[model samples]
Target: MSDTAPTAARTEAQTMLIAFDGSPEARRALTYAAEFLRPRRVEILTAWEPVHRQAARAVSMSGLRQADWSPSGEGEDPAYTEARETCREGVNLAESLGLQPRAHMVECATSIWSAIVDAAKELRVDLIVSGTRATSGFRGFWQTSTSENVIQNCGVPVFVVPPAEEEPDADC
Candidate 1:
Protein backbone atom coordinates (compact mmCIF):
# COMPACT_ATOMS: atom_id res chain seq x y z
CA MET A 1 0.00 0.00 0.00
CA SER A 2 1.07 3.61 -0.43
CA ASP A 3 1.85 4.11 3.31
CA THR A 4 -0.68 6.93 3.15
CA ALA A 5 -4.35 6.60 3.84
CA PRO A 6 -7.16 8.03 1.77
CA THR A 7 -7.21 11.83 1.57
CA ALA A 8 -10.99 11.69 1.59
CA ALA A 9 -10.96 12.22 5.32
CA ARG A 10 -11.18 16.00 5.68
CA THR A 11 -14.64 17.52 5.15
CA GLU A 12 -15.59 20.47 3.00
CA ALA A 13 -14.97 23.96 4.26
CA GLN A 14 -17.12 27.06 4.41
CA THR A 15 -14.30 29.04 5.96
CA MET A 16 -10.93 27.51 6.75
CA LEU A 17 -7.72 28.89 8.17
CA ILE A 18 -4.77 27.11 6.61
CA ALA A 19 -1.73 28.00 8.67
CA PHE A 20 1.11 27.94 6.20
CA ASP A 21 4.74 28.00 7.35
CA GLY A 22 6.50 26.47 4.35
CA SER A 23 7.13 23.25 6.31
CA PRO A 24 6.61 19.79 4.86
CA GLU A 25 3.76 19.29 7.26
CA ALA A 26 2.32 22.59 6.17
CA ARG A 27 2.71 21.51 2.58
CA ARG A 28 0.98 18.25 3.26
CA ALA A 29 -1.69 20.19 5.04
CA LEU A 30 -1.87 22.25 1.91
CA THR A 31 -2.86 19.14 -0.05
CA TYR A 32 -5.51 18.17 2.45
CA ALA A 33 -6.68 21.76 2.60
CA ALA A 34 -7.03 21.79 -1.16
CA GLU A 35 -9.34 18.83 -1.00
CA PHE A 36 -11.38 20.43 1.73
CA LEU A 37 -11.50 23.89 0.28
CA ARG A 38 -11.59 22.97 -3.38
CA PRO A 39 -13.14 25.73 -5.49
CA ARG A 40 -14.13 27.46 -2.28
CA ARG A 41 -12.89 30.77 -1.03
CA VAL A 42 -10.23 29.89 1.54
CA GLU A 43 -8.29 32.31 3.65
CA ILE A 44 -4.59 31.69 3.97
CA LEU A 45 -3.37 33.06 7.25
CA THR A 46 0.40 33.28 7.38
CA ALA A 47 1.83 34.55 10.62
CA TRP A 48 4.91 36.77 10.71
CA GLU A 49 7.05 38.71 13.14
CA PRO A 50 7.13 42.49 13.21
CA VAL A 51 10.18 44.73 13.15
CA HIS A 52 11.70 45.04 16.63
CA ARG A 53 12.75 48.64 16.25
CA GLN A 54 12.21 49.35 19.93
CA ALA A 55 13.57 46.12 21.40
CA ALA A 56 17.03 47.62 21.48
CA ARG A 57 15.64 50.43 23.54
CA ALA A 58 15.22 48.08 26.48
CA VAL A 59 18.21 48.18 28.83
CA SER A 60 18.26 44.45 29.43
CA MET A 61 16.73 43.36 26.11
CA SER A 62 16.12 40.00 27.73
CA GLY A 63 14.39 37.13 26.05
CA LEU A 64 10.60 37.38 25.96
CA ARG A 65 8.29 35.45 28.23
CA GLN A 66 5.48 33.30 26.85
CA ALA A 67 2.86 36.02 27.12
CA ASP A 68 5.34 38.65 26.07
CA TRP A 69 6.28 36.42 23.21
CA SER A 70 2.65 36.01 22.05
CA PRO A 71 1.56 39.63 21.75
CA SER A 72 4.83 40.85 23.14
CA GLY A 73 5.83 43.01 20.22
CA GLU A 74 6.70 42.93 16.57
CA GLY A 75 10.04 41.62 15.40
CA GLU A 76 12.05 42.50 12.28
CA ASP A 77 10.55 42.85 8.82
CA PRO A 78 11.76 39.34 8.15
CA ALA A 79 8.71 38.16 10.08
CA TYR A 80 6.45 39.30 7.27
CA THR A 81 8.92 37.86 4.81
CA GLU A 82 8.41 34.42 6.26
CA ALA A 83 4.67 34.94 6.17
CA ARG A 84 4.93 35.98 2.56
CA GLU A 85 6.75 32.80 1.67
CA THR A 86 3.96 30.84 3.32
CA CYS A 87 1.35 32.80 1.39
CA ARG A 88 3.19 32.22 -1.86
CA GLU A 89 3.42 28.51 -1.22
CA GLY A 90 -0.21 28.39 -0.22
CA VAL A 91 -1.26 30.18 -3.39
CA ASN A 92 0.55 27.65 -5.52
CA LEU A 93 -0.83 24.70 -3.60
CA ALA A 94 -4.32 26.09 -3.49
CA GLU A 95 -4.38 26.47 -7.24
CA SER A 96 -3.07 22.94 -7.64
CA LEU A 97 -5.86 21.72 -5.38
CA GLY A 98 -8.43 23.56 -7.48
CA LEU A 99 -9.25 25.87 -4.63
CA GLN A 100 -10.09 29.55 -5.03
CA PRO A 101 -8.08 30.97 -2.19
CA ARG A 102 -7.12 34.41 -0.92
CA ALA A 103 -4.02 34.97 1.17
CA HIS A 104 -3.56 37.19 4.22
CA MET A 105 -0.20 37.84 5.81
CA VAL A 106 -0.59 38.24 9.57
CA GLU A 107 2.33 40.29 10.81
CA CYS A 108 2.43 39.96 14.55
CA ALA A 109 4.84 39.50 17.42
CA THR A 110 6.15 36.39 19.17
CA SER A 111 5.27 33.06 17.50
CA ILE A 112 3.03 31.63 14.81
CA TRP A 113 0.54 30.50 17.44
CA SER A 114 -0.09 34.06 18.62
CA ALA A 115 -0.31 35.36 15.11
CA ILE A 116 -2.76 32.64 14.08
CA VAL A 117 -5.06 33.40 16.98
CA ASP A 118 -4.97 37.06 16.18
CA ALA A 119 -5.81 36.39 12.56
CA ALA A 120 -8.66 34.09 13.48
CA LYS A 121 -10.21 36.73 15.68
CA GLU A 122 -9.74 39.40 13.09
CA LEU A 123 -11.00 37.24 10.26
CA ARG A 124 -13.76 35.58 12.29
CA VAL A 125 -12.97 32.28 10.68
CA ASP A 126 -15.58 29.57 10.97
CA LEU A 127 -13.17 26.66 11.02
CA ILE A 128 -9.47 25.85 10.90
CA VAL A 129 -7.67 22.93 9.26
CA SER A 130 -4.09 21.70 9.03
CA GLY A 131 -1.90 18.59 8.74
CA THR A 132 -0.33 17.09 11.82
CA ARG A 133 1.44 13.94 13.00
CA ALA A 134 -0.66 11.23 14.60
CA THR A 135 1.19 11.50 17.88
CA SER A 136 3.16 14.16 19.72
CA GLY A 137 6.60 12.66 19.38
CA PHE A 138 9.86 14.57 19.76
CA ARG A 139 9.56 15.99 16.25
CA GLY A 140 5.78 15.74 16.10
CA PHE A 141 4.96 19.37 15.50
CA TRP A 142 2.37 18.14 13.02
CA GLN A 143 0.91 15.84 15.64
CA THR A 144 -1.03 16.87 18.71
CA SER A 145 1.43 19.66 19.27
CA THR A 146 2.45 23.21 19.68
CA SER A 147 0.63 23.95 16.46
CA GLU A 148 -2.44 22.85 18.35
CA ASN A 149 -1.94 25.93 20.42
CA VAL A 150 -4.08 27.55 17.77
CA ILE A 151 -6.89 25.20 18.70
CA GLN A 152 -6.48 25.94 22.38
CA ASN A 153 -6.60 29.66 21.84
CA CYS A 154 -8.87 30.18 18.87
CA GLY A 155 -12.58 29.75 19.46
CA VAL A 156 -12.96 27.74 16.31
CA PRO A 157 -13.12 24.14 15.23
CA VAL A 158 -9.77 22.76 14.04
CA PHE A 159 -9.33 19.67 11.94
CA VAL A 160 -5.84 18.19 12.08
CA VAL A 161 -4.84 15.66 9.43
CA PRO A 162 -3.30 12.69 11.20
CA PRO A 163 0.23 11.76 10.20
CA ALA A 164 0.82 8.56 8.29
CA GLU A 165 3.80 6.24 8.28
CA GLU A 166 5.84 6.71 5.14
CA GLU A 167 5.93 3.67 2.90
CA PRO A 168 9.16 1.71 3.05
CA ASP A 169 11.43 2.18 0.09
CA ALA A 170 10.66 -0.06 -2.84
CA ASP A 171 14.35 -0.06 -3.73
CA CYS A 172 14.91 -2.00 -0.53
Candidate 2:
Protein backbone atom coordinates (compact mmCIF):
# COMPACT_ATOMS: atom_id res chain seq x y z
CA MET A 1 0.00 0.00 0.00
CA SER A 2 1.09 3.57 -0.76
CA ASP A 3 1.21 6.35 1.80
CA THR A 4 -1.51 8.84 0.76
CA ALA A 5 -3.65 11.41 2.53
CA PRO A 6 -7.48 11.29 2.56
CA THR A 7 -9.85 14.20 1.96
CA ALA A 8 -11.31 16.03 4.92
CA ALA A 9 -14.90 15.30 5.90
CA ARG A 10 -17.72 17.82 5.41
CA THR A 11 -19.10 19.36 8.60
CA GLU A 12 -22.43 20.79 7.49
CA ALA A 13 -25.17 19.34 5.31
CA GLN A 14 -26.58 21.81 2.81
CA THR A 15 -30.22 21.14 1.98
CA MET A 16 -32.68 22.45 -0.61
CA LEU A 17 -36.21 21.55 -1.66
CA ILE A 18 -36.70 20.99 -5.38
CA ALA A 19 -40.24 21.26 -6.69
CA PHE A 20 -40.70 18.65 -9.40
CA ASP A 21 -43.33 18.72 -12.12
CA GLY A 22 -41.74 16.19 -14.54
CA SER A 23 -40.51 19.09 -16.63
CA PRO A 24 -37.08 18.97 -18.26
CA GLU A 25 -36.26 22.18 -16.42
CA ALA A 26 -36.73 20.39 -13.08
CA ARG A 27 -34.42 17.61 -14.17
CA ARG A 28 -31.87 20.22 -15.19
CA ALA A 29 -32.16 21.81 -11.74
CA LEU A 30 -31.41 18.50 -10.09
CA THR A 31 -28.34 18.07 -12.22
CA TYR A 32 -27.17 21.63 -11.63
CA ALA A 33 -27.87 21.36 -7.90
CA ALA A 34 -25.83 18.18 -7.66
CA GLU A 35 -22.96 20.02 -9.28
CA PHE A 36 -23.30 23.33 -7.48
CA LEU A 37 -24.44 22.40 -3.98
CA ARG A 38 -23.59 18.74 -3.53
CA PRO A 39 -26.35 18.71 -0.94
CA ARG A 40 -26.53 15.82 1.52
CA ARG A 41 -30.31 15.91 1.61
CA VAL A 42 -32.77 16.78 -1.15
CA GLU A 43 -36.47 17.24 -0.64
CA ILE A 44 -38.64 17.20 -3.75
CA LEU A 45 -42.00 18.92 -3.48
CA THR A 46 -45.13 19.09 -5.64
CA ALA A 47 -48.30 21.20 -5.25
CA TRP A 48 -51.89 20.20 -6.01
CA GLU A 49 -55.37 21.60 -5.36
CA PRO A 50 -59.14 21.14 -5.48
CA VAL A 51 -59.45 24.85 -6.36
CA HIS A 52 -63.11 25.37 -5.51
CA ARG A 53 -64.02 22.27 -3.58
CA GLN A 54 -66.09 23.98 -0.91
CA ALA A 55 -67.81 26.26 -3.39
CA ALA A 56 -68.65 23.41 -5.75
CA ARG A 57 -70.06 21.26 -2.95
CA ALA A 58 -72.15 24.18 -1.74
CA VAL A 59 -73.37 25.01 -5.23
CA SER A 60 -74.51 21.44 -5.81
CA MET A 61 -76.33 21.29 -2.49
CA SER A 62 -78.05 24.68 -2.76
CA GLY A 63 -81.04 25.02 -5.07
CA LEU A 64 -80.53 28.75 -5.64
CA ARG A 65 -76.89 28.46 -6.83
CA GLN A 66 -75.61 27.63 -10.29
CA ALA A 67 -72.38 25.98 -11.41
CA ASP A 68 -69.43 28.30 -11.82
CA TRP A 69 -66.34 27.97 -14.00
CA SER A 70 -63.10 27.58 -12.12
CA PRO A 71 -59.81 27.50 -13.97
CA SER A 72 -58.31 25.16 -11.42
CA GLY A 73 -60.94 22.57 -12.22
CA GLU A 74 -62.88 21.60 -9.13
CA GLY A 75 -65.92 19.30 -8.85
CA GLU A 76 -67.34 17.90 -12.11
CA ASP A 77 -64.70 19.80 -14.09
CA PRO A 78 -63.15 17.87 -16.98
CA ALA A 79 -59.67 19.08 -16.06
CA TYR A 80 -59.79 17.69 -12.52
CA THR A 81 -58.87 14.13 -13.48
CA GLU A 82 -56.04 15.34 -15.67
CA ALA A 83 -54.72 17.55 -12.91
CA ARG A 84 -54.76 14.66 -10.46
CA GLU A 85 -52.85 12.46 -12.85
CA THR A 86 -50.30 15.20 -13.51
CA CYS A 87 -49.66 15.59 -9.79
CA ARG A 88 -49.17 11.84 -9.47
CA GLU A 89 -46.77 11.92 -12.35
CA GLY A 90 -44.80 14.62 -10.62
CA VAL A 91 -44.52 12.56 -7.43
CA ASN A 92 -43.51 9.46 -9.36
CA LEU A 93 -40.87 11.43 -11.21
CA ALA A 94 -39.35 12.62 -7.95
CA GLU A 95 -39.28 9.10 -6.50
CA SER A 96 -37.66 7.78 -9.62
CA LEU A 97 -34.87 10.31 -9.23
CA GLY A 98 -33.90 8.55 -5.94
CA LEU A 99 -35.42 11.26 -3.78
CA GLN A 100 -37.60 9.84 -1.02
CA PRO A 101 -39.86 12.88 -0.57
CA ARG A 102 -42.63 13.75 1.83
CA ALA A 103 -45.67 13.88 -0.46
CA HIS A 104 -48.45 16.44 0.15
CA MET A 105 -51.71 16.82 -1.76
CA VAL A 106 -53.47 20.07 -0.99
CA GLU A 107 -57.14 20.47 -1.85
CA CYS A 108 -56.99 22.87 -4.81
CA ALA A 109 -57.55 25.62 -2.28
CA THR A 110 -54.68 28.12 -2.49
CA SER A 111 -52.34 29.35 -5.18
CA ILE A 112 -49.38 27.14 -6.14
CA TRP A 113 -46.92 29.79 -4.98
CA SER A 114 -48.56 29.95 -1.58
CA ALA A 115 -48.56 26.19 -1.27
CA ILE A 116 -44.84 26.10 -1.97
CA VAL A 117 -44.18 28.68 0.71
CA ASP A 118 -46.17 26.62 3.19
CA ALA A 119 -44.33 23.43 2.27
CA ALA A 120 -40.96 25.10 2.68
CA LYS A 121 -42.11 26.38 6.05
CA GLU A 122 -43.35 22.97 7.22
CA LEU A 123 -40.14 21.27 6.07
CA ARG A 124 -37.93 24.08 7.35
CA VAL A 125 -36.11 24.14 4.07
CA ASP A 126 -33.54 26.76 3.19
CA LEU A 127 -34.25 27.13 -0.51
CA ILE A 128 -37.10 26.62 -2.97
CA VAL A 129 -36.45 25.34 -6.52
CA SER A 130 -39.03 25.36 -9.27
CA GLY A 131 -39.44 25.67 -13.05
CA THR A 132 -41.14 28.24 -15.30
CA ARG A 133 -43.33 27.34 -18.21
CA ALA A 134 -42.11 27.72 -21.77
CA THR A 135 -42.54 31.18 -23.22
CA SER A 136 -42.12 32.28 -26.80
CA GLY A 137 -42.96 35.92 -27.27
CA PHE A 138 -43.12 39.33 -25.62
CA ARG A 139 -46.42 38.56 -23.86
CA GLY A 140 -45.07 35.29 -22.52
CA PHE A 141 -41.92 36.87 -21.14
CA TRP A 142 -44.00 39.58 -19.48
CA GLN A 143 -46.11 36.97 -17.72
CA THR A 144 -43.07 35.04 -16.53
CA SER A 145 -41.43 38.11 -15.09
CA THR A 146 -44.51 39.23 -13.17
CA SER A 147 -45.21 36.28 -10.91
CA GLU A 148 -45.76 37.38 -7.30
CA ASN A 149 -46.79 34.21 -5.55
CA VAL A 150 -45.21 30.90 -4.44
CA ILE A 151 -41.74 31.91 -5.58
CA GLN A 152 -41.86 35.43 -4.25
CA ASN A 153 -43.65 34.83 -0.93
CA CYS A 154 -41.18 32.30 0.45
CA GLY A 155 -38.85 33.83 3.00
CA VAL A 156 -35.98 31.68 1.81
CA PRO A 157 -34.06 31.97 -1.43
CA VAL A 158 -35.73 30.63 -4.56
CA PHE A 159 -33.99 29.19 -7.63
CA VAL A 160 -36.03 28.58 -10.74
CA VAL A 161 -34.78 26.26 -13.46
CA PRO A 162 -35.85 27.13 -16.96
CA PRO A 163 -36.09 24.73 -19.87
CA ALA A 164 -32.77 24.27 -21.65
CA GLU A 165 -34.19 25.36 -24.99
CA GLU A 166 -35.93 28.30 -23.38
CA GLU A 167 -33.02 29.46 -21.25
CA PRO A 168 -31.75 32.21 -23.54
CA ASP A 169 -35.26 33.60 -23.89
CA ALA A 170 -36.39 33.19 -20.29
CA ASP A 171 -36.15 35.99 -17.77
CA CYS A 172 -35.16 33.80 -14.81
Candidate number achieving the greatest lDDT relative to the actual structure? 1
lDDT of 2 by residue, 45-139 (tens): 65554536646655776865766675543356544555556556665655666554444544435456776677789888877777666565887
- Tens digits of per-residue lDDT for model 1 on 20-59? 7777777787787666545366887776655453343242
* Pairs in clash, predicted candidate 1: 49-79, 50-75, 51-75, 52-75, 132-142, 133-142, 133-143
Q: lDDT score of model 1?
A: 0.69
Q: After superposition, which runs of candidate 2 have C-alpha atoms over 4 Å from their true positions?
A: 1-14, 51-100, 134-148, 166-172
**Model 1 regions lying over 4 Å from their true place:** 1-13, 36-39, 50-76, 133-144, 168-172
How close is every model to the real structure, measured as TM-score?
0.65, 0.57
lDDT computed for candidate 2? 0.60
lDDT of 1 at 58: 41
